[model samples]
Target: MRFIIEVLLSGLAIFLAALILPDSAASVDGFGWAILAGLIIAFVNATIGTVLRFFTFPLNILTLGLISFIITVLMVQLTSYLMGSRFDVANFWWAAVFAIVVAVIQMLLDGIFGAKPRD
Candidate 1:
């Protein structure tokens, strides 16, 4: 199903983040938890992130869209806390870096899967 594929893709993103960021730690043994965390993250980003972005449109514009990284880090921290997973990211900076890596990996996967429409 699409949902299952998305979850797996998210887990792959998390794994890639863990691999790419030295300070970001994730356990392969916690794949189920990672999937659940990813689902929660996707839901929060879809709902809360959308609302926050709308309200912070001015800041987003002023920052040239850089503030999105902060939002992503916060969402990741929230997901980690909610899941009670041992996956540990040291600080906001590390979280941001990890998030960027995850985003890149996700985008690459989406490209490979042709999930995103080509121009």
Candidate 2:
């Protein structure tokens, strides 16, 4: 139940982020594609993303957390690759932008829906 709601919210965030991007930085074919992309991203993040983050933790510390952000951008690229034509990010730099945009939108949505921060 909670997972389903989160997926929907993520899809909305993706859709809005795609629309918000300028100069063709990113695009989503439609709401359905956005939903599917959201699901795929969530799955990958829970699996491969976690391992990647764990392994990169040392480098992340050395880079002042910049490596974590690079990992995020790479994940966005991977998500776009996995989704093929339906969801597209122009490049690594654009993927970074898209990731940031989606994250911001998701955070806003979570706040709007009364999600409280964990202590």
Candidate 3:
């Protein structure tokens, strides 16, 4: 249930980010494509990304987690490649911007859907 919720929230974030970016920079065909793209991204992150993170653990720590952001950008680009015309990111900078926007929205969604601690 939690995993499903996360995926849906991610898709919503992606859709929102696509709307935020100019059409030349990034684009999503529709909400359904956004969801599918998000799923591909999640799968890619879970598999390839996890291994990259593991290998770069020391650099990640030394860089104070900046490397993870790079990984996120790569995942976004890969997602675009996997989805073809359904989702597109023009270049690295736009992909980075999209990644940041998606991250921010996803953070907000998690906070809202997350288990709250009792005061």
Candidate 4:
């Protein structure tokens, strides 16, 4: 249930970001593809992101977690490529912007939902 909610929220965020970002196009299918893409991205990030973060822990620490931004961009690019859809983003900068927007929205949602346990 929580996973589904997260994916839906992410899809909404991506759709919103697509509207704001330049040269970024998403389908007009009422966010169906966006929802699917968001789910795929979440799965990939949860599984692959964990391993990548573990391996790059030293760099992550040195960069003060900035490397995660790069990872997010890569994940978006990977998702776009895998989808093979017309939802094209112009370049890496736009991709970065999209990632940042999605991250901010997701963070806000996560905060509101309090999915993570307090320390």
Candidate 5:
């Protein structure tokens, strides 16, 4: 139940990102694409993302934890690549912007839903 809600919230976050960002920055075909992107993002974050974070801990600490956003940007880029035409990011800068938007949405949702921090 909680997992389902988190997935749906992720979908909403991606939908919000697609709506907020300009087409030049990022693009999503529609709600269906957003939902698919959300699922991919969640899966990648849970699996590969964890390992990457662990390995990059030094860089993360050196940057005062700001490097996590770059990791998020990479995850978004990976989702865009895996999804092909359905999701596209213009460039790394745009991916970073989109990542920030998604992070903000996630934070807001977590606050409202009282979801515990993952780490």
Candidate 6:
């Protein structure tokens, strides 16, 4: 349930980001592409990203967690690379911006949807 909700939120965020930053973020011809990209991102972040965070713990701590932002950018670029035209990030700077915006929106959505109700 949580996974499905997160993926939907991510897709919404990606679609919105592409609309807002057309020069930086792009989805191929349909909302499906954005949804696919979002699923890919969620999978990568859960698997590879977790290992990366574990290995880069020192760097993340040293940089006061800013390194996690870089990791997010890499994840976004990796999605573009793997999906080719289905998803595209203009460049590293653009990926950074796109990733930042997506991350912020995802966090907010998760906070709302994943929140526990008080007794």
Best by lDDT: 3
lDDT of 3 by residue, 1-119 (tens): 66676778889999999999999999999998999999999889999999999999999999999998899899999999888999999989999999999989888888888844545
Better of 1 and 5 by TM-score: 5
Question: In model 3, which runs have C-alpha deviations exceeding 4 angstroms?
Answer: 114-119
Q: Positional deviation of 88 in candidate 4, in angstroms? A: 2.6
Which stretches in model 6 have alpha-carbon errors above 4 Å? Answer: 107-119
Candidate 5 regions exceeding 4 Å error are: 111-119
What lDDT would candidate 6 get against the real structure? 0.81
User: The CA-based lDDT of model 1 is what?
Assistant: 0.74
RMSD of each: 2.8, 2.0, 2.6, 3.0, 2.6, 2.7
Native-to-model Cα distance after best TM-score fit, residue 65 in candidate 6, in Å: 0.5
Number of clashes recorded per candidate: 0, 0, 0, 0, 0, 0
Which pairs in model 6 have colliding backbones? none
TM-score of each: 0.80, 0.90, 0.89, 0.79, 0.85, 0.82
**Residue-by-residue lDDT tens digits, candidate 4, 1-119:** 76677678888877777776655433313478778778778777888887888899899999999888788777777777777764555557777878888778778877887785535
The window of 10 residues in a row where model 6 has the poorest summed lDDT is 22-31
Candidate order by decreasing lDDT: 3, 2, 5, 6, 1, 4
Residues 9-106, model 5: lDDT tens digits: 88888888888999878889987788889999878988888899999999999999877777878888999999998999888999988988988998
Q: Which stretches of candidate 2 lie over 4 Å from their true place?
A: 116-119
Instruction: State model 2's lDDT.
Output: 0.88
Candidate 2 backbone collisions, by pair: none
Task: Give the clash count for model 4.
Answer: 0
Tens digit per residue, CA lDDT, model 2, 1-119: 67778888999999999999974799999999999999888788778888998998989899998987887788888999998889999999999889989889999999899675455
By lDDT, is 2 or 3 better? 3
What would the TM-score be for candidate 5 when compared with the true structure?
0.85
lDDT tens string, model 6, 1-119? 65566667788888778777875455544578888999898788888888999999999999999888788788888999999987898888889888877778777777877755445
Which residue segments of model 1 deviate by more than 4 Å? Answer: 23-29, 116-119
